[model samples]
Target chain A: MQKILNDKLVVTADIVLRIILYLSIVASIFFLGKMLLGPVLGITEYKSGLKTPIEFSVNEQGTATFGSNQTVPVNIEHAKGLFQIDRPVPKTLMVVFFLLNLIFFGLILWVIHSLWMIVQSVRQKNPFIVLNGRRLHIIAFSMIGIELIQGLANLIKMLYLEPRLNFETIIVHSKIHVSIHVIIAGLVILVIAEAFRIGVELKEEHHFTV
Target chain B: MSIRINLDVMMARRKISLGELAEQVGITQANLSILKTEKAKAVRFTTLEAVCRVLDCQPGDILEFIADEKNENE
Candidate 1:
């Protein structure tokens, strides 16, 4: 019964990984298409509209009154100069950014492929092979690479692109928020890869012992 | 590296085939082959005892310790 349950789990995991792999491929293709046709199709403009918070007052009866009952005359700042898509420099930078995104997605696909290989090994009832250990290591390192790329991409956008566009207002709001959980998860995977390496060595020793 | 198994020599002396010795010793022929080929990392006490019993020999008779040439030279 335990064997049956294990088999079922393996199958389910394999199916899920395969689905994710297919989805990643499709998304990558979509991104590639977007990158290729973005300039020609006038989709290169990355617009971030400003949002104003609505002010309201609440009474004891839970009745709310909006600050503006009529059409309010407000000074609107045009952010056209912030993202000058017509400029050659920003256009090239945006293309490069999209290319970096493609590379990031490619790395993700590679990680998924490595994990798929590991699941295949498990399904074969030989998960402790040296190849699986190597695959785990690849997955761990790829995850770290993905995180680094994401951070670098954000930094480039915030530091270089934002300043080049003279967007002081937008730069104040832009911040690089690195996910600690992702780094921790990568470290955990690295440890698991190390364990797999030890397991492979032990398995080889056990095989030769007899 | 010099601790050698004389299982093949003992089996030859006893006029017993590998299969027969393995069957009498209650071990797989493949494992017995590993012992004979001196490829096994270590032998279990129970396996050694069974092998000795099947061959009608002492443990020392089937196992030999030879000094390494490097150690001897040193």
Candidate 2:
């Protein structure tokens, strides 16, 4: 009698995508934790509010910028900080910060979208995503978009606010924090690359014919 | 999950060495070994196509579904 083990490509595309989606989510949580750790650890402080702990200070030209959350106390010599709010136009400047942060915010929306799609697939028990499904592409593009947004947001803030915002006075100054920010962003990109690898490479096989 | 592969019996029936099959299939002996030993995670359609061509037999000849003894007892 002949004997062999079953090989039915048990790993369906749905299962693969589900695994990748969950893996990405786990990586994202790690990212958020790493980004927020400094403030939680009391290594840095947000000067503006106790909740954020990031110190904002303005440069000689009267513009200030904010950094990732840290809670070192503020000492404004003649009142200059990480973010400079011109008394005359402080409302307009606040709006800019809100927009800048929110614009990059879409990446978070994309992440949520991908996770939701995975859950739907799981519930429906779809074996493989429909060819060119919107969810599949969103998962891929959203992850890539998240990395791009984080990197670009930092650059935008730096170009617009860095010179005007002097973080030199803060005990946990910008230098050490900025590098960690980049490293965490890089890890997110690496995970995104792995997701694409798993998604696009797997192929279906048909079982035996004479 | 319930499917089984019966390469061993087919090989015996055909009287061909695993090495010969590997050569005919143009796959590495190690990979062929994995398939023969049931350690393979997956089998490609091309590989299945190759196996059928080399053996001159249908896949059904090499794979079978005996109602499991455990299932029968139950």
Candidate 3:
């Protein structure tokens, strides 16, 4: 019967959601552990000593500068932007960067977990419940929050951190951009949440009708 | 609060049991119970016609309207 098929489909979707939820939780825990013990365990050395094709050398006066013998490709001029660093980044800065990344990942995991809860309700054939609408609203807002955090982090990197480095110069190929598409997608989800609320009201009315 | 179903009164007058009336009217017992208890929000014309046919009564005999004094005061 069609009812049996629908129930099976919902069960499968529930299983998939549970898998994703477990994965997100494990990833979040791993990131949290790394952030907590990274400084003490000398994990910062691996991240700070990143090797690149471009080399730097120190002069007799102890001034650090880029090596002139480095080969420059013709298309290098058309690259998005240039980021030059004179020295290795400090361990404290690396920890802060990791912390910011962890926060972003946490927000993403929260959105996924909210979706998982909504799907659980759907599997129970109660998709029109008020809690599902609230969960959808949470997902929409979390998506917008993630995009805002990403934009702010980018701005900080461009304005404050980049300028503080002595030999760092970023050639402006394009303006700093925020993802307008993500904001629009969040608005769409918000509208869908409102529609779900109205649907729940209508379903309740129908249930009471003869 | 204004519209009321008089299904139970008509069934009593006709001397018909709930199960007999529901079977003759081609509706479930639970649904007929809802109509008899006046708990239904609205009745369909087809269902009303079936019930009237089964009980040998007019539509007016099964449905009644009474105004609420609270609405008049408001």
Candidate 4:
């Protein structure tokens, strides 16, 4: 059978992925540098946006009544659940959030780099190399790291803002949400890495068989 | 490995050069070298038959099983 990588489609895909990887790296570096150094230069604003869920409760009861419960008329003067608060954030918390964002960005770069390397290997018709397996492993772990850092950032933001704000009817709360799909995607990559490892071993064995 | 390929000794006994043997056996010299150097992970029945026919020897002459010293000690 002809190698799939020899096809024009695969060549095009490899070129496209390489371009995307380079662009993502350049853009991430530029944004991360601006976020990290702009404050020191006194050019960046201190305003940060925080998005959290809000529970609404009303004191006035409506005429409609359910079984053992009265309907309360709720007025939403502001945004509803999962609303954003745009204000100045404390420097310490902002710095910590920025650092977390930086780590997440680095993980994203690693994932793209690994994917590009894997595509390059495929283009070379040596897809079952040990290095590709290691790259896949790196990609898997980096995905998990990105998820964990995002969750940590969300938790930190919630913890920092929960006690400081006081509201009569609206409860601003943030919960650390774990994305199961991302974790599963990472696990699928891990399984692909194992398959690549086994393929490499089998290829080596076949190569030596005489 | 405990199972070793004594192909070099057999080739020497038969006075057949590596190039000649590889050509007669219908395989590449690099692959024949791997078998001769005991670096082969496996031997196909067809390849073993061809090598035995070329060397005019039995399978026992090319392959030998030696006890591992570590296993014996354990």
- For candidate 1, lDDT tens digit of each residue in A1-210? 999998999999999999999999998988666655664244565222111111122222223445767444444332222233343344566566767777899889999999998998889888889988888888888888888887777776666654444432332334554677888888899999999899888776676553
lDDT of 2 by residue, A62-88 (tens): 334458664454444343224423322
State the weakest 10-residue window (summed lDDT) of model 2 chain A. A45-54
Cα lDDT tens digits, model 3, A102-130, are 77888888888898888788777678887
Better of 2 and 4 by lDDT: 4
Clash number for each model? 0, 27, 0, 0
- Please give the CA lDDT of all the candidate structures: 0.74, 0.54, 0.73, 0.80
Model 4 DockQ class: medium
Q: Assess each model's interface with DockQ, reporting 2 decimals per model.
A: 0.46, 0.03, 0.42, 0.80
Top TM-score hit:
4
Q: Per-residue alpha-carbon lDDT of model 4 for A123-148, expressed as tens digits?
A: 77788888999999999999988988
The deviation in Å at residue A164 for candidate 3 is 2.6
Put down candidate 4 lDDT per residue, B1-49, tens digits, no spaces.
Answer: 8998888899899999999999999999999999888889999999999
Query: What lDDT score goes with residue A91 in model 1?
Result: 56
TM-score of chain A of each: 0.72, 0.38, 0.67, 0.76
Model 2 lDDT, residue B47, Cα: 85
